[model samples]
Target: MTQAASSAADRRALLRLARQRLRARVRRPNAGDAITLALPAVLVAGALWSGSAASVPELATRGDAAALGMLLAAAVAFLSYGMLFRAADDPFLRRLGVESRAVYAERAARLLAAGLALVVVLAAYAARAGRIPDQLLPIALVAVLTAWGSGAAATTLAGRAMVTRSPGSGWGCLTVGMWDREVAAAAPLVYAPLIPLLSGGAAGAAAFGTGWPGVGVSLAVALVLARLGARWWEAAIPRFGPQLLEMAFAPPPPAGVGELSVGRGLARLLPRAAAAVWARDGVVTARRFAWATRIVWPVAIVTLALLARRGTDPGTRGWVALAALSVWMLQMVALVGLGRYERGGRRWLDRSLGITPLQRVLGRWAFGWGASLWLGVPLALAWGWWTDAGPGWPWVFVGAGTAAVGAIASVTAAGWR
Candidate 1:
């Protein structure tokens, strides 16, 4: 085939793959998935619709515009990084004879397209809110350029972290000696463009009293980052591509001390059959990095409590904190409940064990409930004491009930699989 024909064919193949993946995701919606997806859309839609003509002028001020640009850039960086690093399609694509650079390009193109679409929506909203056309143009341009730059930087960082096998370096340490050291390092460089974008936006607001200066700065940053990421991707693929594949197919790492002890110690406190199942799930939690990272949720809950305390009356503050904690508990049903099953050979082992469905359900429920209380109890008490409210001990029962529901849902889902 001619070079041109080959290039066209590759484009068609990638597009087909993208379409199929999108279709599969669309077809597999469950109640939890629908709610999880809808909540974000609802929040964004609510924000957009809540503002009025009266608020538009103040909202379109330079500082607010700059903050908006920074916020968009930050969101793009985080989403792109997570999507690129956690994806498991590298090995599958490699097997299909897809070039690594082409795979990265395809993914980056999709992200850039999504970013541009978001820019258009925001710009339209600004125009509808009576912002001057001149101001809207520059703000839109800056947003598009910033998103492009942020996505490229994130992709490059994710790629580098994926290829890194040394546990002592970068975020490889997060692997905690389990699985491939695939966690992207929380490197500040991935977000370096935010500084320039923010500065440019502020400078544009000050100098031109418009967003024009930001457009040029954003474009330059985007071009440089894109070119650099492209070069690094091409060079790294030949050297580390095989290693990347090996990492994907690698067996689960040996259990650490925490995994062993946590399960066994918890088992001692439960009934015999349920204890066995609970111990197993507990070990699974330890092995999964998702659970460890969820520590952030509790931290966020505390931060919200502290922030609430500043302005509100003690009664209101206490209620607000309690409400936030309750929401967190409810969310745990989806986050922890659905993730109880093991994958691959271990899944087969689970089936082969002479454990009854009732025992499995009871065991998993106990595990989830225990996990919830372990995190939630301390948080509730701290909030109560700090706010001079009475002990929030009743939440323990509420947490247990929610956790049991999550456990049932998870086990039922696993059975279907």
Candidate 2:
């Protein structure tokens, strides 16, 4: 084949591969996953509708902001949830009829396509609602493109970092570590939704217009980074072998001792009896980098609340609902990680120490609730100060506290099982 023909053939092959993979994914989704994926859209729509008390321009602005948030959340979910690749499939595909590079190419292409789709969906939604002014349309497209490209690049790097630094552990331990990294990386992207605030307002379209060159530069840099990541993976796979690949994608086993650790700290900060547990939890959290997520999660919620305040009319019930939901989601993540640590790493020690089940449960609650309040109390106070709901900030904090307790109660109860 001529060089041009060969390149054309390769393009065709990659497109074919990507299509087949996408079709396979479509077939695999059942009701549960489908419903879960749709939840964000529903929540966004509901929030927008509830805030209809605002003026048309205000509603439009809020809708646009929410759309931006939804896109960021989707990107974060893509990066953090699972193994970066089906690395195990390389040998099988090679034996059958595929090069490993093609796999990476297909994955990258799919990710890029998803980013483009986000742009299209947001544009269509805005156009349909007529919320975004015509003059701002081009700027909106540029902004979304910039965010998507930069986000994709960040995710690729994060995945590469995790895989490169991944230690040799059993399937279960490795999987847990991967999960931890996902949560940590995703916590930062929470701020991405607030990128729109930088534009200021409809009047600020000129601001974004001036930044167009920067956006283009970011997109180019992202493409280069993504390519580098794929190249790195393509080179790494051959040495990994089928066994290691299998272990990488394998279902995680029950959580265990590897999930917990004791770092340098006071095991005597609390009651003499519970000091060890408290110290271990504190040290493990501080040293392991997991504590960062606790801070990030709350910060993200507060950012969202502030954004809502800007987008919606004061005293809108939707704003409160949105804040409450953010807290619930943050607490859910904390509970899951904390629960796993307790069950896998600390349970045996607790039993031996004659730590009553109540004490154990309370300890876990204390750990999670404190983490929640670190950001939650200030978030509640801010929501009150910013929104028409200021007078009811007391009630808002009460509700926030209640939700935190509920999350802990649920997680602790699950540990009881």
- The CA lDDT of each predicted structure is 0.58, 0.48
* The best candidate in terms of lDDT: 1
Per-candidate TM-scores read 0.64, 0.47
CA lDDT, candidate 2, residue 20: 85
lDDT of 1 by residue, 173-215 (tens): 4434334233334333334445435543543344234457757
| Colliding pairs, model 2 | 267-275
State the lDDT of candidate 2 residue by residue for 302-381, as single tens digits: 55566455724644456545655565465555454555546554656667778765655455454545555555555555
Report the CA-based lDDT of candidate 1 relative to the real structure.
Answer: 0.58
Error of 1 at 319 (Å): 15
Clashing pairs in 1: none
In model 2, what is the error at residue 40, expressed in angstroms?
Answer: 3.2
